[model samples]
Target chain A: MDIAQTSPAADYPATARTTPTRHLERAHYDRATVHAILDADFVCHMGFVADGLPVVLPTLYARVGERLYIHGSTGSRPLRSATDGLDVCLTVTLLDELVLARSAVHHSVNYRSVVVHGRATRVTDEAELTLALDALVDHAVPGRAADCRPADAKERAKTAVLRLDLAEVSAKVRAQGVGDEPEDMDLAHWAGLIPLDRVIGTPVPDPAVPEGTALPGYLRHLG
Target chain B: MDIAQTSPAADYPATARTTPTRHLERAHYDRATVHAILDADFVCHMGFVADGLPVVLPTLYARVGERLYIHGSTGSRPLRSATDGLDVCLTVTLLDELVLARSAVHHSVNYRSVVVHGRATRVTDEAELTLALDALVDHAVPGRAADCRPADAKERAKTAVLRLDLAEVSAKVRAQGVGDEPEDMDLAHWAGLIPLDRVIGTPVPDPAVPEGTALPGYLRHLG
Candidate 1:
């Protein structure tokens, strides 16, 4: 990611203080901290305003070198707005677990998230299109890019891919132990961190798979 | 839950056409589908317009009966705008898995999400405030409502809670096997469903916990 292009204050202001902000003293902004949070999740909620109205849409996304790619049909309204030079705000969150504490006020959740604000440009070049598609493949399944059939001309034309250079991005994360109030220490309440994780199960072969197709190495050892 | 107050277009438009219409599929409007998806996640990206500019913020959310409650400071910009009667868009998504397929076009992720558009009303009633807080707790950890100390008047006064009745909500979901094209089935590539799950881990006790506070039943059996 291009850390040099990112301006934290421009993307995340300290004034947006919600009650959650008070507990956000431990949140970090380092790139490694941010990317770890982003890489652990698979979906993002893209938010934007069109015609003076707030619109939030859920879409699939992949992180390539320094950019995030989002795909949608050419007919989708949000995609059309984004392709028309609109500024977009995108956010991805990975909810690690529910932090249960002895006190109600200290109760919290452990999560990691990245929020990026930028103008999205539609990917039109043929070379970039192929690369974006391949990046997306490897993003979901490591090493699957070379193994899959590449998109043909007709297929490429039907899909709309938008790229947002991760220029002004900020990552906010809350992890570790519960926050029990000092006075609640003596209360007979169960207070601890319930670590949450995303695990992949055994692959279920497609019923229509050819007689003897083998499972890929990546799938066999997916984290 | 007040189902009648929910969005009029509660069902998604489903058609076999290349692109589905805006108003036909159950995936678009079913309250159960929408609530299930919304309640399963922990955070939401809230979008609203300020000074004709778009802003998106990530915040924790809890669903109460038929309403979604999001807590922020009394002075927050988006919360202030929402209280001033501006329409806001709130979106929540749960990423289930990374779908790695043999074909590039078939690459996708399994997810469930709900997008709600409505005006947010600042919650003021003391009774409703307590209920909302408990609901928030239970939403994060099922059955946590009875385990923690109830919020007193002072704590409630310090918190700014806003409720957006679950009106005008739409749920969109995509789950199941990959959408590999017929010709790509024999491409000698691996194809199958990699299930994604959120697993809860062993609890970590708070450092300041009293000598012998035991874990509560709710914390022991969390899903």
Candidate 2:
């Protein structure tokens, strides 16, 4: 395995903030659990306080070892506010299935989610910034980073990158089928899991693309 | 139409927090945009400050008219803290497609997201709580509320509901295909969109479910 790949699943010590306030059984503190959930999804909802009011924004992010990197225009409010090293909460959730129970009280979704709470520090070093950008590209379309030209001086200058060390992070997962009460077992209603998944459809070519350009090798297996 | 249903979209007045610092072209303040995105997604990431640190948790929610209702165990920290009428940020995002660009800088995801900032008020009135609970059930599976027995007084006593008026809200959408820069348009790489969608698969009946019970009408239409 490449060193750049997430290190083998290890354990992340649980802190007071990492522990779940309820459903403690569903909480996980393993490094592998957190990394697996984060790697499967690119979009994360990042929460931060601005003017004493909470603000959450959806943005793309990539993970490299103990750090998660998020990028955006330097002028973006969330990114700008994050550079000041303010406390932030980043969450990535993958909805696996919708559990439809015989009773309304038991309806729940099968999902895997990781939440990280930490202060986001700006990634200012030029070399690390380049690698973070590459990671972001590869995270979206694996192996496509090397195929395309890297961001030049101007493009790199326009982008802002923030890194949050995955310290106070926890993963919560629910993978079981419908979990209804024993009393509802005899109900004449259908109770089960409606597995939900996101699949990549056929690649649509750009209108101006060259006549013979074919879909890249990495994208052919996306779906 | 049931008055409980979200009313026809109108407009949400923009405030300082609702305004986007960048990508102004993608920011939408119209009520229609906000409601459409909110109605499509079931889980929302709610952010609130806990001990001066931002905490974001994924929770089930439903929309009724101008308010969003989130339900959870009263013992949960986030839910318990929210009842104090503290400010919160709630966000829902739907990932539509993957835009594979010719260059790394332009790679993006086509998505629609709504961000709401407000102080969440605890819902205590019994009549309104029933409506909110019904809305939550229907939000997960349309027509589900009538199919299953209503929550008993004991269940309702165990759950806590918080309502946030959709006052300061904004929707940001990116729906186009690959948007590579002009100079890189002619790059010899394939550039296009790989559409992504979440589809419900065949429902698996619970192991204890009766052998011949047919799937419910609501589950049949989900896929």
Candidate 3:
């Protein structure tokens, strides 16, 4: 049975598609790990077959419970084709650090990434669509949906959201120091990790805005 | 003729798959822009058709003029299949800022992303393979590839590098300020860009480093 129909399990049952072909030790199937990695990033690369060829597109996404919502215009080809349930695989990677090993082959990045494979269906129900839209905004910026004006009926009608259940999901992570070989440990080379992070910067308000529009509580952190 | 076969073209010939279906104004076909976007990021989401299904995997990559190289283990299934020329699409996105509009529907991210569609073949030639490996390491950390020990014969044989010429490629970028509607500009909501960037941190040396081992000059900037 598909895991989506059942209650949330402690771990996502790994399917053949979810299994890692390499670095088995870094693969993760736990629901917490999968969800956490997905929540950390707001954008995802969605791959889908078009004319029997693979196409990868970057788009905004949000994780709502056991389902992932991808935002696209109703006029988009992928959105139109997804109405018939398109096969899609979405991947999100958060690069944490650059691991510098003693040798070229051993060098790697410390990253938390999640790969989700599933068939996505277009969201149609009004209430669910509203929920998905708000979730999309809040996922990227907490409390952002409430701060901004809700989409009008016309705006809602023009937008399309695809929901892919997090049934076939797995997270692969490598968050450690340099994995230099024992023999290479004595090599005259620096081996370690260079920490990397994406940081939020100060807000740049639109100049046309009324003079004293206060920044919302959600954006005050950046202010 | 494919752009690779001819001398370097100013733009990649956009195919049916490379053209954006929506927001065509944001699509870029210039080779310089595409190359710059690919060079700025070391990691990309590689999409390929596996068993007639789409699979998106994150991996490190580097651009060598009109060609892009993806690194993988020799034993990896995708790498194995690429030896026979697998249809692949690789996408790299560098997020710049979060565009917070006055309305929910208009919210977006300021990003530069390049997508390449090609049939990838495994690089088997000794010179090209070595160049790909060095390019992969140098792309991620400039000047560091020369500082590390070159891979031995055994290690080189264990690695697989896939070459995908940038014939059908396009870049999409959104770099401007919040695109709020004129009517919504007066709305009592903050509308602007929240600048975002990934920054590199100081290096953390391995525990076994000798007492007097000096950090290389290339890494002194971080020190």
| Interface RMSD list for the candidates | 2.1, 1.2, 1.0
Error of 2 at B3 (Å): 8.3
Better of 1 and 2 by lDDT: 2
The lDDT, on a scale of 0 to 1, for candidate 2 is: 0.85
Cα lDDT, all candidates? 0.72, 0.85, 0.88
Clashes of 1: 11
lDDT of 1 by residue, A1-223 (tens): 2223444334333233211334466555556666666676656788778667788887767786567888877767766666666678788877777777877877887777777778888888777777777877777676888988888888888778998887666677777787665776777777777888877888777777775666777766752
Q: What tens-digit string does per-residue lDDT give for candidate 2 at A54-158?
A: 788889999988889999998888777666686899999999988878787888999999999888988888888988999998887788888887888988988
- Candidate 2 vs candidate 3: which has greater lDDT? 3
DockQ winner between candidates 2 and 3: 3
- The window of 10 residues in a row where model 3 chain A has the poorest summed lDDT is A1-10
In the range B1-223, model 3's lDDT, one tens digit per residue, is: 1224445556677888777888888899997798889989899999999999999999999887788989888889899887789899999999999999999989999999998898999888888888889999999988888989999999999898999988888999998888887899788888888998989898888888776667788888887
* Worst window of 10 by summed lDDT in candidate 2 chain A: A1-10
In model 3, the runs with Cα more than 4 Å from the true position are A1-9, B1-9
* Deviation of model 3 at B74, angstroms: 1.0
TM-score against native, each model? 0.87, 0.95, 0.96
TM-score of chain A of each: 0.85, 0.93, 0.95
Docking class of 2: medium
